[model samples]
Target: MSLGEDGPGTRTRMPEQHAGGTGRRTQPQPRRALVTVVGVVVLLIAALAFANRGGKSDGSAAADGTSGTKAGGAKGSSAASATAPTGQRPVTSKTAGIPAGFAHSVQGAQSAAANYAVALGGVDMFNAGRRHEIVATVYAPSVSAALQSTLDRAYSADAEKALGLTSDGTAPAGLTFVSRTVPVGAKVTASAPDAVSVDVWCTALSGLAGQGSTKPVSSSWFTVSEKLVWTAGDWKIQSSTQKQGPAPVNGDDQAATADEISGAVQQYGGFTYAR
Candidate 1:
């Protein structure tokens, strides 16, 4: 008979004793075998049911109304929203030719970091006058003077000459120098009412772009971290540092000619970054 054909408590027939043999009846071997098989089947079904219930419970909890509130909680939500753009309008003012008047919020901190990074990484920083203006305008009042002094030393005449520029930070004749930072994204690492820290990921083009130039324009990726404080009704850099990127592999596109690159740089304008 097939397994499970009879109920658990069903009785099975026993073989009749031989006429001349002792009359005590014995339990049937087949009945005992059937019972053992049924028990094993029942136990396997119960185990499978338990495993499925555990899996579904976890899934249901994640699918509860809120978005991205999975097993990792706030961390998961932050990761989901980090690069997602909000439709809020960007700041509409400038100070010292740099974007200013950011909102006093986490998004504002990120926006400030990105815009400050662009200003700091521009070719203007190579020029003493422009560099001093940028540092004064972007950095906190308490730190601006010291920061300016340090930068002056770092971008000295020797440094300009090494980069194929004149002592005044002018490009050599017949070449256009390119130093531009394009922010890929920004995120706030820490934030409070009065201060915040943000990281801005950027790709930059730097070097001389023209025929006969030894330093052809090249691209690089880096991340800049800035600590900003709310001072004088604006977000200003208190400190800053940079590190080499989470760079992607270089693509196979052919390099543009010097004239083309220089023209493109001149025609395209930089942006006012926002979160």
Candidate 2:
């Protein structure tokens, strides 16, 4: 998955740890590929800036019907092996122009990626300062500033209310906000002395409103291809993109209650994904 650009306020909600929101995925459904070609534009909300959020525009591109680890070949897009990683780290240092360092192993990249994904998908994205910090922390320098400003406005106070969030995105009373990102796997796409690109397939828990909603926080699988630059011993996003999925058969596991959804989100802390 390689992203062209990120637009703030692109959707009506932000993800909670398990925020009962994200739409459901039934792998048995037919595929009518819907490729959302988002323009290179960033929105600065004239009003309710932080209120803005993003979601899949109905059905998105299906690996248009490809299998896990095998889809990249269909499109002639190079990707790393899909075999499970041997979570390890490199020896002394891995360099990228400026003073550089990277974890010597795939596990390290996974850990970093998972944590970055959580941060990227978390409720914190609504706050101005936090938005800047997160974009700066996860993204490469080349793309941070613009993303920060756009996100700052996109996650405005107005954006919050729409998703049933406080101006800062917290659950009310006994209700807990559910927002989470679970990494399914990671693969190296292209690695260089200064940068690396990894694709992370994941399940994102999001949504709001009532007990029964079209967008229930059901599991979904999508790949996030990140191009990271080695900076100060850490990986940062240069750019990223996402596509529908090599999603597996939907499970028969019964969905949880909203409260259970909230509880599960609170109980499970996401991982730092890698490959």
Candidate 3:
């Protein structure tokens, strides 16, 4: 007896031996038949084991939800979609024109950090009165006064002139000043019952836009980490710092004209970011 060319559990018959004179034939050897059967069973068992191993590996990959093979077996990262929605309703109220009344959870802290980053990096930061309002609204009382004092000097008249803005932080005649921060994503680094630390990745547009403008609008990427505390039933920044990003490769799209850029900025309104 021998195995056939087909994969597993394929049986082949052995020729019978002929008797010398009585024209009688004997059955194939029982031991040989037994050996053939055992070989076939072992092959079947191995095939099943290999199939199971592959199934388990695929299941593990699905559970991770971070990566997978694409068409033609090329691997691709799924990290961008790893953030799952929490299904909680976003804050519907504003305190001093900033989103407030966050839920007392990690997601709430992340949302607050992202919105605060936006408020801090806005064009209003160049205006003394508006900057003071923003600082007071987003920051804890313990730090707002000092922060406002520091910012007042930082955005003084000399700084405005250096940036081609007037003493009032307004753009020159026939020009539009652009300073906006858009939060890309947020992550909670640490969490507690009444406090949390979150890092918000952001991209900003700044400078002046108009014909023959020396300070053309430009884009930048950065990350802001904020330590927040739950004060008066809302999240407020206790302290914060910013660092250069996590930026992507610059795209090769053609640059828009100054008027087009200025128009787009004016037409589009900002959003209240949530995790």
Candidate 4:
């Protein structure tokens, strides 16, 4: 299967693997469509964001449904005094496996979006059940219902097959699927008591791991922008969008083997990110 920018929707015939010895690099071109799909989910987040933001005036808190707070937590905005980290853990609890109960401050909102991005851009997203759980956990309740169905279609079976996965989203036997997002930093674009928008610069690793794997895990850089709402004592993602990144020049370090990369992924557990 070949990959394309449309993500899971694009499919082509899979090329036959060449006869090779152990640890051969004679693999076929990887289907980067999987990578594109990984990034596109953020677009779904943005769609939901607009839905959540609809009907709210863009002005002060006095404006119906708007929170009056300026950027950087200025005196007039509840976000004022919140420009810096509170040094406090953003949440004391978890909801359906997602962090919950964020502080009602700008810092907390940024932290929530950063962490949510990591969760959204993860391996679980390829798996239907887990994907639903993550969405419900991080997205506002008001939008998750519709978002779930939307995402289901977005990550369709055709897309999975393109990436060498089974229609059920499982990696081929003996191959490990890889999808992860690491946040480099976050900046609040806008902040208010009820709404906050943050952009998180991040790098994502995706593809697969296995001997003779065509897609031997690769990395890409992207930025995720999230609009969050203070809801039910936590910051829930309302919308999100993504763009190709602010990537730096390549490093001089030598690339590792497929086995080594696979080992590292298994050995290193992901963290609960904070801004």
> How many steric clashes between backbone atoms does each model show?
0, 37, 0, 10
TM-scores of all models? 0.71, 0.62, 0.70, 0.71
- Model 2 TM-score is 0.62
Q: What overall lDDT, based on C-alpha atoms, would model 4 receive against the true structure?
A: 0.57
Q: Which regions of candidate 3 deviate over 4 angstroms?
A: 1-84
lDDT of 4 by residue, 1-275 (tens): 11011101101112122110011011221112111132233344221112222122122331001232355544332232223333454354666566667667665676677678777766667678987998889987877877777777667777567667778776788887777676766655666557877776677677678887877777667666777888877789776666555777878988888888878777766665554
| Model 1 Cα lDDT, one tens digit per residue, 152-245 | 6556677567667888877888998777777776655555567766666677777678999887777766666677888898899876655556
Candidate structures ordered by TM-score, highest first: 1, 4, 3, 2
**lDDT score at residue 147, model 2, on the 0-100 scale:** 66
- lDDT, candidate 3, 34-85, per-residue tens: 0012111100001001111111001111111123221233444423334554
Worst 10 residues of 3 by lDDT: 21-30
- Which residue pairs overlap in candidate 3's backbone? none
Each prediction's RMSD over C-alphas, in Å, is 32.6, 10.5, 31.6, 13.4
| TM-score of model 1 vs. true structure | 0.71
